[model samples]
Target: MNLSDSRRASIAWLFLCFAWGTGFVAAREGVKYAPPFLFAGLRVLGAGLLLLVICLLTKAKLPNRRQLATLLTMGAVIEGFTNICIAFAVFYLTSGMLSLMLATTPFWMVGIESLKPQGDRLSSRHTVGLAIGFTGMVGLLAPKLIGVSYNSHLLMGCLVMQGACVSISFGSLYVRHQRLGVAPFMGAAWQMISAGVIVVLVGTLRGEWVRWHFTPQVAKPFFYLLLIPSMLGYSCYVYCLPRIPLALFSLHRYINTVVTFLLGWLILGEKFGVGECFAVVVIFTGVFLVQNSSFTVSKKEPSS
Candidate 1:
């Protein structure tokens, strides 16, 4: 692309990253009154319908059976379970700390990918980088995890927070392997709708629906969750995918860290100590290395 185009792409990417970060904060706020699962369900269901309308207006085809299955599976693992875990985590952990735990996803994805025989192999540099970063992440989270004698409620909360981390990691990996023939927005819509159904079912079974209150104070955040971040954010990312470069796209993870930290501090009164700052730097550096590394190597065998 020309210089002008490149500059525009950069700005656009930066904007999307910022939106994601702020959206994370919005989503966290929305869940304060609603159960996490219920909040997630409403967000996805509303987003799905909105996307579906757009698709219809543009004459997009519904997914075939294979694509439907793929979306359903992805929805279950990624959107459905991931949101459930996050809701559980929100009960115990500060959003900032929870976001830090999420920053561990790249490390886990790299480590898991290393086990594949045909794919890229992890290098010593990668290993060292991950270790340094992960050590700092642990340091940042250690205080919260220590001392079992605190409120039993807090202890259970920590466990849920850890579960959220795992859920998000698993979801990312699942998405990396999925194949769908439709437009990215349409594919995403399917996943959101499917996951939303599961969330509603689970939440209702858990009595969230029966106990739900819908005053304007609660409704305001819920509406924003459905319309802005959940629907608009997903659409914005998908729209940019065809226009952005892969290398630059990698920056989303890093930008997400910054955004989440800032929002957590600004909106939630979350604090970061010296150790947390150190950890954030290390984590960001490690992610940069991992994303940029040429982990794949292919050398043709000598002709016989």
Candidate 2:
């Protein structure tokens, strides 16, 4: 690629990362007025519909039966289950904490991939990076660790956020393995639509839809989530995936976490004391180590 094209891709990826980073705050605000699952369902559904409209206007080819099935499965695990976990988690976890926990996704990806046939093996550097990353996680949870009996909710929230990470990592690996020939935008559209259907179904079954309310306050963040993060953010991610190395692209997670931490503090008045800040630094360092190590040895793969 030419330098100009590379620069534009970099810009797009950076914007996408920013949108994802800020989405935690948007989701946090959105759930305050609407039931979590229902809110998530609506947001994703809106984005899906918008993308489908774009695909239609552009005369994009529709996926075949097998592709549709794979996309739907990816959606269910990656977007559906992942968002539900985040929605539940934010009730007890700050947006910053949620993002920080998610930064562990690369570690999960590495560990899971190691188990796959022809997968990348963990180097000594990966081992140290993983150890450091886990240590940082422990640091983030120090307060809860000190008083575990009192912070069961926080513990559960952390666990749920980790579940989100695992789900997303698996989704990424699935995409890498499948190597679908579908257009990036088309694939994302189907995934969002499928996820929307699944979440809405779950929300209805759980009575979340019945409890949902629509008001101006909720609409603002809802639209932000739909247009900015779900639609545009993911579109940029898909566009950049084929253009960048997976390990190098994954470095965006650090930017995401830092942005989330800052936005949470600035906009939401979320607290971050010296210890928490230190933990963030530690986590970033560990993630950086992992990214650098992987860049040297990891094979390129598509991300979800």
> Cα RMSD to native, each candidate?
3.3, 4.5
Which prediction has the highest TM-score against the true structure? 2
TM-score of each: 0.86, 0.91
Clashes of each: 0, 0
lDDT of 2 by residue, 88-114 (tens): 898999988888888888888888888
Model 2 global lDDT (CA atoms, 0 to 1): 0.85
List candidate 1 segments past 4 Å from native: 1-8, 147-178, 297-304
Q: lDDT per model, in order?
A: 0.72, 0.85
Clashing pairs in 2: none
- Predicted structure with the largest lDDT when compared to the true one: 2
lDDT of 1 by residue, 61-87 (tens): 988998888888888777787777676
